[model samples]
Target: MLLDTFGRQAVDLRVSLTDRCDLRCTYCMPEQGMTWLAKPTLLTDEEVVRLVRIAVTLLGVREVRFTGGEPLLRPGLVGILTACARLQPRPELSLTTNGIGLARTAAALRGAGLDRVNVSLDTLDPRTFQRLSRRDRHHDVLAGLTAARAAGLSPIKVNTVLMRGINDHEAPDLLAWCLERGYELRFIEQMPLDPQHGWDRSTMVTAAEILDRLSTRFTVTPEPAGRRGSAPAERWIVDGGPARVGVIASVTQPFCRACDRTRLTADGQVRNCLFATGETDLRTALREGGDDPRTDARIAELWRAAMWGKKAGGGIGDPDFHQPERPMSAIGG
Candidate 1:
């Protein structure tokens, strides 16, 4: 197991397939002046599958979530998923995307062994979506979600970020829309991962405020506190029954103590924490060719060290807290 000094085991692995995105969401990155990773710097599809294999077959990882600026943009994605699905102790596979190309790729992805997906869809309004995402693909995202459902991706999750002045008022409406469509909705508190670094704590919406907004139209009740494990989202029963909603309050309610996630960037760095300022390089060791056992052992060793050195928390509450140099886009979701 990838055990840390704090007695936490990293069982969930978030793999970044690429740092390129189709939509330039204002909260994620600037629309212009973005410098993307060089193609050569990224891990090959085979390298990704191998690393994931090591994590699963060797390092005790059970869930593999492929994230990116948009993972759907990766050309070799289907092949990578196919390979990972064939691992000895096959891990539960999922993807986090902006839902741009899912209309074309959802069926292939589900057929290739993707179990589910968490797509980012902030607003139900097209104009609000364009203003927030800096793109006119609002309908495209909705269409993609429909495609994902038809493709049999179970419990297709919709991740929404409610900005203060932007689309905060649409919480109730978003929940109603999601409930009607049977799409699980999760509202996330905006973190300090944007490249522009314009995050303001006062102006940002909190989990309490989100629930308050939703309560206007839905009788939302918290699930038992003990029910939430390492999952980032704190789920709430909606409308008194099986229907539910989640709030990922990364800033206001940090779940770092129960964080089971280990992030692998598109370029092959091990990130113990999302707000970490440092990274352990696994790419160089991966490229140093050797037998599969030897390479896998080395990868496992480095991963263990990275987790062992993980900080107690994401550090957003500290007086000296500073945002990570790489934006969320480069670092993956």
Candidate 2:
């Protein structure tokens, strides 16, 4: 296992297939989408698979997650998943998507060795969905969820960002809908990863607020700490039944002490933390390949060096915190 200076093991790897997304979520990007990286600049399928192989075989990474502006937008996603699944002692493969294009691809993706999925759906209201995403794909997302379940993607996770006075009022409705459908729902606190840098802490909903609202309609009991391991979401049993919900309190309760995840951008930059300001360019080294063993060794060294300096936390609530230049989409949310 690769241990950083803080004694945190790097066991989870998040690979960004592309920086382009189909939806323009207000909290993620501007209404007018930003310019995207050129096709040649993005890592090829072969390069991505090679990096994952090195991480899994060499670095002690046990879980591999595919993320992007929208992972479904990548053309070679299925092939990428197939390649990653072929690894010996296969890492747990999952994806995070906006679900706009998942209806047609969920089955194919599962067939290609995808274990599960996390779909981002903030509101069930059509008008609010359109207003938040700057697009009308609410029906598409619903269809995608149905198709995902039909494809046997067990425990499909739904990610919802609760914004004050925006979708916060619908907490009970969202939880009930997920419980009825048997999907794991997680409410995420809005962070400062937007490209426009307009994140106002006051307008962001805290985990306490989320619990207080949900407790009104359901018996919300806190799950034991560490049940989720290094995972971000903190789980809770809803109404004392099998149904449950989670709150990713990234802002108020930072989980940096147990953070074991590292990120690789679509352009091949390795980031120790999601909000990291510095990046190690692995594309240059990979493209200059000479000996396979030598290049793999160099990549491992770069990954270790990057994680060695990882800060204790994302610092979202710190007084001196500064949002990264890249938006959440670019950072592989």
Candidate 3:
């Protein structure tokens, strides 16, 4: 296991397959999306697989999650996933997507050894979805979710970012909808990752406020502490039953102390934290490869050095916290 200076073990790696996405969510990017990385600058399928192999074999990473502007947008995504699954002592493979294209590719992805998925769906109302995403494909997202379930992707996670005066009022209703369909709903606190830099702490909804709203309708009880180890979402048993909901309080309540995640951008830069201002470039080392052993050693060294400097917490709540250069899509949400 790779242990940082703070004794935090890096067990999970989030890989961004592409910096391209279909939707332009208000919280993720500007109405007009920012410039995307050139295709030549993006890592090739072989390069991505090589890094994952080193991560699993040398760094002891046990979980690999593919994130993107939308991972489904990557043409060779299924092939990349299949390659990762063939690793010795294979890691748990998962993907985070907007779900617009999942309807067409869910079964193929599952067959390629993808273990499960987390789909981003902010609002159940079609009009509201369009207003937030700047796209009229809300129904496409719903269809994608249905297709994912039919493809045997168990425990589908629905990621909802709660923005006050917007979709915050639909908390209970959203949870009810997911519960009825056996989907695990996770309410994420809006972070300062938007490209427009319009995140306001004053207007952002808190996890406690979310629970209070759910309590008005359902018995929202916190699951026993320590049950969520290094996982961002805090689980809760709803209405004293098997149905559950989760809240990722990244802003109001930071989980950096227990954060065991590291991210690899589509261009092959290693990021120790979501809010990190710097990254370690592994793409250069891979492309300049002559000695495989030396390159592998350098990869391991870079990973350890990056994690060694992880901040104790994400300082978004600080008075002078500045947002990172890349938006959520490019950075791998």
Best by lDDT: 1
What TM-score does candidate 1 reach?
Answer: 0.98
Clashes in candidate 1: how many?
0
Off by over 4 Å in 1: none
Query: What does candidate 3's lDDT look like per residue over 1-333, in tens digits?
Result: 667778999899999998878888888878774899998889999899999999999998999999998999999999999999999989999999999999999999999999999999999999999988999999999999999999999779999987788899999999999998999999999888888888878888999999998988999888998889888999999989788899999988898888899899999999988998888998988888745678888888888888888887678768877789988889997
What is the TM-score of each predicted model, taking all chains together? 0.98, 0.98, 0.98
lDDT, candidate 1, equals 0.93
In model 1, which range of ten residues has the least summed lDDT? Answer: 289-298
Q: Can you give the lDDT of residue 218 in candidate 2? A: 96
Instruction: State the lDDT of candidate 2 residue by residue for 1-333, as single tens digits.
Output: 667788999899999999888888889989884989888889999999999999999899999999998889888999999999999879999999998888999999999999999999999899999989999999999999999999998779999998777889999999999999989999999989999999998899999999999988999988876588887999999888678899999999988999999899999999999899889999999999746679999988888888888988888767898889888898896
Alpha-carbon deviation at 79 in model 3, angstroms = 0.3
Highest TM-score: give the candidate number.
1
Q: Candidate 1 on 1-333: residue-level lDDT in tens?
A: 998899999999999999889898888889899999998899999889989998998899999999998998899999999999999898999999999899999999999999999999999999999999899999999999999999999889999999888999999999989989999999999899998988788978999999999989889999977999999999999978899899999999899999999999999999999999999999989999556568788888999999999999998979999999999999987
lDDT of all predictions? 0.93, 0.91, 0.90
Question: In model 3, which runs have C-alpha deviations exceeding 4 angstroms?
Answer: none
